[model samples]
Target: MSLLSTQHTLQAYYLGLFGRAADPDGLNYWLSQLESGTLALDDALMLMANSDEFSERLQLPADDDWLAQVYPAYFGRPVDAEGGGYWSSLAAQGVSAPVLLQSIMASATGADREALDATTSIARFYSQQVSPERYDPAQTLIQEGLRSNEALYAELAAMDEQFDALTVMEVGESLEGRPLYSASVGSGPRKLMIVTQQHGDEPTGTEAAMLLLEWLSGDSPEAQWLRSEISLTVMPRVNPDGFERWVQLASGEASPDTTIDPRRNSADIDLNRTWDSSETLDLALIPEALAVRQEIARFQPDLILDYHNQNNYINAAGELETISILWPTNDLIDDQVTATAQQAAVALAQGVAEFDYGFLSLFPGGDTPQIARNGLAIDGVPTLLIEQRGLEEMELIAYEGLAVNYNALSSALILEGLMSMIGVITELGSGGLTDIDPALALQIPDRGERIQYQDIYTLSDERIDKEGMPTETELQPEVVGVSAAVLDDALAA
Candidate 1:
């Protein structure tokens, strides 16, 4: 066929696969072949079943009869002795028609300018439809209540109350000399330190920390109680340079001309992996990670939860064998932590389900430990890595829709988990004791349940009996009530 004819034919094939006949003559020719037993129905079906769009429309039972009638002539009859059918003989390997079309369009005879333009247009269109639009990572922190470092520090400084008299420390500077801020809240015996934005891309946790800080500074009863109970030190933006780089990449304005480049700030080092090695850290003195290390040394937290987005399955830290509370030494802590993580997973799954979203489980050998989860666990600070489903390109664009729901659900889970720890500490500390047996700490059920994407779907399905804990509403009545009261009090305070 001529080049133009080939292109037209391919386009018609794609349209047919999508259940649309682009050229009536071409479609009728294929249909006539099937009727005459020249073109086997199975072969025609194979040609038509190349795209997700095609699979979606093939309403199985509804189209089964039509498919049965048309599939046999295109291909020879099935060789099975037990009444083998054409439906069972359909080709398994199907090409993605849209991708194929784009490739074909790119290689077609055209000027360089035209080709590049077509390719860029196609890519951008696909990305816009399928990828997440980028935003300032700090926006998530702000939504979570931290605001910017400057804003948070200024807010803290303005409040002259004794509770707000804690020291504000500027540990290190970003590449742009934006000072990293850490505020020491309270003088409690057990110090808890949280550092956010280890990966510039994962901004959800950073935002959550900021929101928690804002809540603490406000006049809510829970905030007041939390402040009195624990000395919380939070470093909001550990990687400002990386975050700025991410923002610039997302906006497509990193250079004089607009384009996207995924790199660790200007130096291009993965900040999460920079720890424990001088060579890596020296090549790129990630001010964020360095500053966070200083803060960690200054105020050692009993527990830590460093957040990141795992594009694959959702998982917490630790192996399945070590995930229970029945083990010795760290078992009680493990149990409580695991229960908390599981409960959070359930809450997150449910929250996403309300919006018809789902996520996969962080199976043992997947992408969790090789990243940051293993690093934190090895460092002796019990940490759990929370993952949100979807890619950066997908989630970041739909961020606004997903953020509030995720943030609220995550905040509640973290708070509940932390409170479980706090309750243990409070009981131990009230008797004028410095420490309690880790074994003696009662295990909180539902701490670290691995709620996979499949589980979320199963629960959300109309037919299945939902497993795991009750909804977030049942788990956090007090927090929910206080959140409502906080809003009312914010207007009144």
Candidate 2:
């Protein structure tokens, strides 16, 4: 069988499995066009092979044999077994060959490049500009990459040395008597408040802050833009005591037999809901709550961002939502304040959506005064909370132990989240965010609640329902709000 001699018609039956990997129904449309000779075989194959849906379905060596049989379909002729074998070996490596692996690697390096050259999507922007090499998610999760209180201070000291504009200050102490630190960076008029680690178990937000510090320490355009345009107030870890317990566990001081999450502070409280008001900041005997409020009071930011993480949510239908944002509001706030916060929320969600279109959502904020995002809004300072779906959920399957996988995923999730924050600030800085519809934010559906939500399963491996708190929405991606596309368009323009 020669590659070019025979003109074999494409089989419309397998079109559902191959080209239209995302939509089974797409086969019906393509099938008619395919069988009618309207849609060329090459075009149909190209559509399926380059898709993210195909990437997930790609089974490597397992698919290699199936592909040996499918090559007749791929090339419109029975491909030589020897030739197919040569190509199959190459596909195992990341080096993509356009003709052989177009369906799997999505047109190989050369073809993908050609496609990328003609058009730009938010996904392409991240792949081109913010490559994973620049912002490593896994490296920081390792032992050396771990950010302990000591590690954070050391990094901060080095950051201060690297950038004179960012000076680390000791604001207060944790309940366990660890130093609580804050930083006032740049001299720009806009004061942006960034708080992290209100929950001791949540450490990636602080890691993201460290990444921010490192970025600002550079002479890059982003660092320079931040220096000249905004003053960032960062309290990287408010709950040092809780983090310390986790750190000790990570270091092997405590047995892994106990539950991995060391969430509470020295006095044992979820500090996020501890700040009722300035006078009522104390929750239980946890001093971390007041310490965080003191830092917030010092900055008096016009816009506030509270960062945290939640478990990755997967509904009964098997859809995943990795990030969720909130424009937290109270009765004292007006539509304008809500809109402004929504603006920030939308921008961040938009920034993140490029990475995974269906992974983000903008939901109602906590109505309680005790919630930091809501409590901060009572004073009319528009606050946005970025809650990344928990990377901790991916520990075992994604990597090694709970510590390693959790830490690495947390760093990655936070970096992705931080990108959205950066995109929001960039949109605001460029004056590209004027009169954008606020209702567009709600168009991003809230992620649905998973029926079997849990932290790491119990020691016996039971998938426990970790929290009784139910999310207000269901989880699915294809609702048609181009939140990320809108922000990406603004950024690209």
Candidate 3:
């Protein structure tokens, strides 16, 4: 078969099983397998039908109801009597679920085929916009080719057109002249400024910020309530030049240069460090950081969440740490700012605790006021640091011994960050963040020694649950009228 024919077949399998367009990695891998005669079209379809994403996405019963769902899922119609009887007999004769799905998909024709072709055409168009290294757990490198500068602009532009409430703007330009953009929405009294990917090498937070923006722009009742209660400003990607170089290094398009650090800007300045004393900073040296500072000055957010990715390390319990969080540890920060930052951190710790896979610990951050975690707080802007797992190691070791589902890890980090933001916004809107005790931030366990990826699973359940203390609503029910369960439902929704 021609390449086009093979792609159409694969696209149908992706649609029927995953309910989405194929990622370039998976599509290319399977296409090569078919073209090389290593696997037939039926073999590929059967394998995909039995994959974890397939089973998790469509939880069809193993009994006769499977036929009821499968026919409609693939062909856009329920099974007719004759087709139902044939599939039912096959099942009765002990045919497997994957095999059954493969058979049903093969039987499409006429209007069903026409519908499939039209939808597949649309899916193909979507598949084009997605980069080759877009998030895929099945692939080894979990956070590869995170949205390019162009892609980020495209997505933000589309969001601007789609959501009337969301406003996407160019806050400043990087030293390389790439426009630094910020998306702002909501109209409540409380304001939040969330900046992600200060370090170009750290890219997960960029995706998480985009996810949060889309959620805030949504029409759900919880989302609507959030808009009514708070204003938000999100700087999704701060260091595009560093990110561009990082991508080049990852894809082997560029050789490593001794003078250049992918974690800093093109001018070799650590963007996070430039914020040390925003008043006296040399703006020409770090244009990216200056852009962020200017936006913060104008927006004057009540709270700032600085999202970033750090090296992987096992917690004090020896289990791999999924995220490390910290409030301002700088002594120069005001007592009130420290307390408010602590409240936000405590709230975030409790929120992240709900996810079973999330391993939270205190980030062993610097006391230097240069980093946003301390710098902004010193200036009386409440800031919290979120250091998620999986970026430094990815560049250093190339995912060795990290036996994890990249897809799940990739998504969990984003959702965990988004939910943390939502939880904080909810509490801040209801005036519940300030009343909580500030000592809880000090109580968060310190990050343990760094370990190789292979050592992550060595220890079992001894990991500390630092935020084990009562949350805002738990400690003071009157402070936040919204129940924890209600807030949780809203975040999930």
Candidate 4:
């Protein structure tokens, strides 16, 4: 095969095994490996198949079920009983997944090869078109694995040292003695506090928050402009103890030493539910919530963006929601504060909607005063809830939908959300955030229906047809400045 053929084959492997288009640097490195005879084609394929990205992206059991799931992805059909038995026997005989994948791909007949070719074409298009600035290699690295508590701390420290505009501070400590760190950048009077990973399992926000910090702290014209307009603060990971537990469980390294419920703190308290203004920060247990509350009181931000991820859900258009937003819905919240949050919601929806991949929805949340969105608003601090599509949920959704393109989708979703957030922050800093009509948030379609993991693909078409399409007017907010396109250019600049 020529170099082009070699590249195409590798790109297909990237999409097949990693669920993403190969980055230019990685592609070049592997090409060199092949050209220099450092690794043969089969060896290269197995190396990629054995990678952490492959394992994490698939998360499939290394057994008959793995074959069952993977066969349909490449061949566009379920594994027949005979094939399953054969694969299972091989698996039992200690044939590694990498070897099995190689064997399976090698065994593909005409139609299977054609289906794979089509998928490879999709990867090629994306790889060719993906914006280097938008889909940075650093962003990809962040998504590869969950960062350890110490690693997160070190990264923030390094950012603080590297960027003159960025500062890192230890605000408090987690119940498990992990430092509760907060990063701050920019110096404008209009303050915005971003809190993410409040739910341990919801991690896209943490990744996006770091990327946002990297962007904001750089010397780009937009970053400089925004810095002159808004003092930004971010608590990237709020529930460190819970996130630690979650990471352990996810990596199959569950320790007998820690709590099992990653959604809660070491004290087994739902940190989100602990955010009641009526209760003192030190009341009862879970110092993570207290640390957040303390930071909020100290920052006294004009707006707060709480980021999270929700279970799989389809919007009114019958498309999977890329992200959902909700403002303070508690009756106790001041009307003006709630209205401001509504305006922010409109800004966020408008920002994300500019990207064709994103489907905005009004996250279905109750008006309980304990959750951060409601509780913070009750205290007269405007807060908006942003729930991105859950990572684990999307993995299962993609499997059910037979979508081998999920890694690309997942990467786009995070990058888009991060850019949208940056745009929203720009608007907030420039006072353009409140210029949008708050009532437009009401028009943002409701999160249409919950799609259970096992049946999302099966019912997707039916739901889409029955639910009808979202009107063009839905969430069409009249904004003043800082649109997603403008921000996209700014980010690249």
* Clash pairs, model 4 backbone: none
Residues 1-493, candidate 1, lDDT per residue (tens digit)? 0122222333234332442322334445666777788866446555555545566755232323323322121111111222223222322223343333333334433222122222222122222122122211111100122233345445545542434535667788776687777876655565556665665555545544544555555555545555566677877657666555454433333442332223254455666665443234463356666777677777886544455543433224421111111111223234454443333333333222222112224323222332344444445544444443223322332221211122233332233222223333233223312333332223323234543332332122222112321232222212111222322232232
| Residue 229 Cα positional deviation in candidate 1, in Å, after optimal superposition | 2.2
- TM-score against truth, every candidate: 0.43, 0.62, 0.65, 0.66
User: What TM-score quantifies how close candidate 2 is to the native fold?
Assistant: 0.62
List model 3 lDDT by residue over 410-445, tens digit each. Answer: 444655665577667777767658677889778888
What TM-score, to 2 decimals, does candidate 3 have?
0.65
Per-residue C-alpha lDDT of model 4 across residues 462-489, encoded as one tens digit per residue: 2122123222232111211112223435
Which rank order by TM-score, best down to worst? 4, 3, 2, 1
Candidate 1 runs further than 4 Å off: 1-166, 255-263, 277-284, 312-372, 394-493
In model 2, the worst 10-residue window by lDDT is: 469-478
Candidate 1 local lDDT, residue 459: 21
Best by lDDT: 3
TM-score attained by model 4: 0.66
Tell me the lDDT of candidate 1: 0.39
Global lDDT of each candidate: 0.39, 0.54, 0.68, 0.67
